[model samples]
Target: MRSAFLIAPLLMMLSACAGEPTRMGASTKLVEAEEAILMPPPGSFSVAGITQKRFSNGLQQEIFLSTTSAVPGQNVVQMRLYGTRNDLRYRDDHLRFRTVTEAGIDAEMRGTLPGIPMKRSPYLVQNDYGAFGYAFGRPSPTELCMYAWQQLRTPEGEKPPFAGFGAVQIRVRICETGASERKLLAFMYGYSIIGAVDDMRWNPYGPPGPVSDRLGHSGNPIYPPEMTAGAEPDAARPVAVARPARRAVQPVAEPVPTALPGAERVVVPSPVRASSAAQPAANVAPASSAGGTIVPSPACVGANAATAAACP
Candidate 1:
């Protein structure tokens, strides 16, 4: 009875553009199909399957565990330990001291959780690595303090150039990430998941500035310059690399028809152009009946780009 987690669906996921409502029965069928397909598999471990054993004599132990399934193409391993932090920000000192490590290895931590004594191992990371950590903290009648984190791994041992971000062919034994954010077991449900992209240590020093350059923006005032205080200005900042929009566009190579077929046929097709900078006020998305916020697709910003309020 140590955890209380739930399977969460991607409720707020970006929706495909809607030209019209699906036929009445289609939406209902979609829900039933998802219900049949999205249930959690059996024997899934919530906390990386490892737990620390502490005896009355103060004997400490670590265990390697497994989840119901590890995602395909994603590297994962689950191990449990014993420890706690005063709060959530993942203080370096706290992580360094609490995480169990062999004498010489320095483990990096990405984020913290409440009941589960978990922190991402950022210390073991490669250049351009990434991770996500979430904690289900102290809950109350009307409030559940949920904390989430996403971290990028920094290169630690300095592999070859291609190894910097190339394919490493890792054999991920297990992963506990589920289909929904609300998929929690009634008992032993308190837990977290920290996913690393390349490495575990999050110290990406570039990209934000380059992103600003791409956005043709000076930087948002909300995130003060001091936020990047120690960041080497020459090095890039990583915050600006939010996911770019991806849309499916089809090519129409056929010509258009004209009324005067015998004499001549008029053929014309619209051109595709990159979009310009969006107005600051244009960020809000319309609310769906399910209360989901929908955002616009990413359009390229080029001097000769086309301007469309929304992309379908």
Candidate 2:
């Protein structure tokens, strides 16, 4: 009776474990929940204090931080714009590329700043001329360029802009440099969403309802002289333009060297040459011998008793 009771409890414990799901069960549910939510509007927040930086090759980099309405001491958004530099400093060619046309902003964000939950797709964006190729953080059509935005989590121990407001929108614009050069330009904007503000969901640059007009324009809060200096020194030696490498010319094949003495020569038969005049056949029956007159021998006649002794 004691042994039966022990076996029943052990069997019941194993069944309970089989009914429960694994650790990944919770992650799968969260991903499904995130996909169902719609992206928030750009007009929900505002950004200010745009800054700038540049490379030696005249490439520009800018960063715009978000502005809060009532929330204090909270960095709701932080945007960075710069020439394409690998966030992974360990890469062989770090910061050598002039643009980030191929890099993913979401992956870049997660790598640079951890512990922040960001959306993967379906971001909100609007431009003045409607010339933007990509509204989301996806690559553009032509050069694989793109513009993207995502929601950022608010810091802990601080109240959000409003109730249920945990994320702030960050916008990034990467387009052509507009110069004759084929380089790219990047613009990032951070905005803070407050609940108390009117929930007017609209394109910020379309009608200029609430956001600032200088969203895309340059030359605002000009950079200091020292900060604007190029990466290369002013008095550095001029770099020589490198010419393309030329293909090696193949030499013409030369005749084989004259055969050494005692070397066996391959005797190839020469074809018979055609003559201007046709000649009579040499194999025809001859009428006379060249050396003397011809005569029939006894052997030419059928073998008889007299013919057998001598040829005709």
Candidate 3:
């Protein structure tokens, strides 16, 4: 009778435990989706597919596969976004290219697979949204690869812009065949965040700054320097006066008059040369001085007679 009572109590306890609902961890309770919440601008890339994993704690990871090829073998870009989450545990979580690359290599070597050697160098990437740490390498003669990561959160020692804390992590990996570095990095610079949490405090980007005081002020006009308030149309504007082209003046040759012993030497203008249609003129007439008349030397008769020998 005592053994039967003990067995009955144990059975009852087991049945009660089995009927209770079990709780799952936040990370393990994830819902799979296919919606695209983040993307680059239109025409920049063609989306092949999207995979989204939404966690129970309002965290989401979106992976995008993009086809950038026009022919058989072209560029391919893969982008991942860890949307802003209110959880503080993920605040310091960020991806590094070297660590991820080494992990991949080790996994391949452990599996007896050929490891791809990627020569990585620090690549600085500038973006309007935020700064990103990028690394690039050539895995093969025809394959180019780039990896970039970014973290957006409130700075240390600064209070949250709103009531709650928010953070975002972004990662991108792209490999293209015969693609230039600039072409591969264009996706990083041109991507945009289209999805955001409902709460205002969950903004990865802080509140917009105040408008400048100069804006809309009466004295501070926002027009180009060349554009006046009442400027005339280009066709109606006054035509600039074109000045007449000045002709170059030809130098007139002067004849050297023979020096007389008692009279001052005088310079006579050379006779103008006549065209072929007209008869040639005679030598210049002698110039009369106060003392007497002085005749020029024959050597200094023509326009070409400016030489010292002719003058002497």
| Root-mean-square deviation of candidate 3 | 20.7
Off by over 4 Å in 3: 1-34, 67-125, 157-164, 223-312
* TM-score, predicted candidate 1 vs. hidden true structure: 0.16
- Residue 105, candidate 3: Cα error in Å is 14
lDDT of 2 by residue, 1-312 (tens): 999999999999998867433343221121221221122235432333333222221112233334321222222222322223322333242223222332566555444333334333333443322322223221222322333544333234333334322122344533221221112222322222221112332222223237676666776544446666345446878989999999999999998988687654343222221121124345323444244434444344465664343321
List candidate 2 stretches off by more than 4 Å: 1-48, 69-103, 122-312
Each prediction's TM-score against the native? 0.16, 0.20, 0.47
lDDT string for model 1 (105-209, tens) is 212211222232332333332222233333342223322222232332224465444333311111112223433325432112322223123342222332232
Residue-level lDDT for 82 in candidate 1: 17
How do the candidates rank by TM-score, highest first?
Answer: 3, 2, 1
lDDT of model 2, residue 90: 33
Residue-pair clash count for candidate 1: 38
Winner by TM-score: 3
lDDT, candidate 2, equals 0.34
Cα lDDT, all candidates? 0.30, 0.34, 0.54
State how far residue 15 of model 2 sits from its true place (Å).
90
Predicted candidate 3 versus true structure: per-residue lDDT over 19-133, tens digit per residue: 4343444333322223455576555666664544443234444454554432232232233333334343433444322223557544523232124344444555568767776
